[model samples]
Target: MTFSLVARDSGTGAFGIVISSSSPAVASRCAHARAGVGVVASQNVTNPALGTLVLDALAGELDAEAALKAVLAQEKFPDYRQLTVVDANGSTAVHSGPNSLGVHTHLEGEAAVAAGNLLADESVIAELLGGYAGSTAKAFEDRLLDGLRAALAAGGEAGPVHSAGMLVVEDVPWPVTDLRVDHSDDPIGELAALWALWQPQKNDYRVRGVDPTRAPSYGVPGDQ
Candidate 1:
């Protein structure tokens, strides 16, 4: 019911995740990332806590594979979960539980990893990785979104995806980009539109959080 990609941008050292699912608000549960740490996508049976646990391990200076291993080791039902991790060094790791849904698969590539369950075919994972890797010239967030779009074009999940989202973390303690289309007929398109609207203001919002005096006003009411 879900497909996701976790990746690190080699050019900017940013980490990002893009996800879509038949379930509403899928990314709220599946996407996780921390600045200077790593990114995690925990899906399948959808234990949202696994995202936090794996991120915690990554924050503890564990590598991607080691972080995933540490979290799964403590999980009571590891066989029902699917997880992907990409650490700060661009190392990637993935786990597909034995009890994963139909046509489930995962792939790891240079600086990126992709996983999907209830997929139209396993090839979706490969296309996702290729899409991100092939778009090295684009901005980091666009590359991540390209991967999600490519997976959908290559045959995404077994059913129509209703929700889609993207998360990106840079040097700050908070996400620089967090966009979601919680429920929609074309969630990816909606998410992309949101990204377009957010991109120019992303850095401004970060500045607002850290130093409001240096932040640019959006010319909205009361902002002046």
Candidate 2:
């Protein structure tokens, strides 16, 4: 129902995801990210807990493989889940089950993990991973968009992408800037444009030294 990408920026330590899905409000349900912790994409049979729990495990300095093992160790039916996790340290883990639909598969690497079930092909995962990992950029948002675009080009979600969203939580989280498409015929394109609008505003706050990305620092630009 969704084709999404999550990425980490090596330069700024930012994390973000861009996604388009045929399902309603896919971003809210399918994409989860925590800056300096980890990202979890839970699909097919979505498990939101995987997002928070996986990030907790990652922040505890667990390796990707070990963290994933521990998370699944608690699940009653692990094989029913399709999940991908990437730690702040760039370790990755993915699970695509044998019982999943025909094209189901997952690929994990140092900086990225991708998984798709009921997809056009298993190769979609690798394509999404390669796009994000190889995109050497300073901006987390751009890297994430690259991943989404790649997934779309690789035959997205076996259907048209409808909704999109992006999130990156730094030490602070006021301006929030959690861009969401809500719904769109071309969600990726719409999300890219929305991000363009958001960047200048973000920089405006930055240049005036208004620091909104931090949770407690969003005060008048110069008076503080």
Residue pairs clashing in model 2 are: 172-213, 172-214, 172-215, 173-215
Q: Candidate 1 at residue 158, lDDT?
A: 90
Candidate 2 wrong stretches, greater than 4 Å: 136-138, 171-177, 203-224
lDDT of 2 at 79: 76
lDDT per prediction?
Answer: 0.93, 0.71
Off by over 4 Å in 1: none
lDDT of 2 by residue, 132-204 (tens): 8777755777777787778778887776768888777554433235788888898889888998888756655
Report model 1's TM-score to 2 decimal places: 0.97
Best by lDDT: 1
Work out the TM-score per prediction: 0.97, 0.81
Question: Which candidate has the top score in TM-score?
Answer: 1
Cα RMSD of all models vs. native, in order, equals 1.0, 4.2
lDDT of 1 at 128: 90
After the best TM-score superposition of candidate 2, give how far the Cα of residue 90 lies from its true spot, in angstroms: 1.1
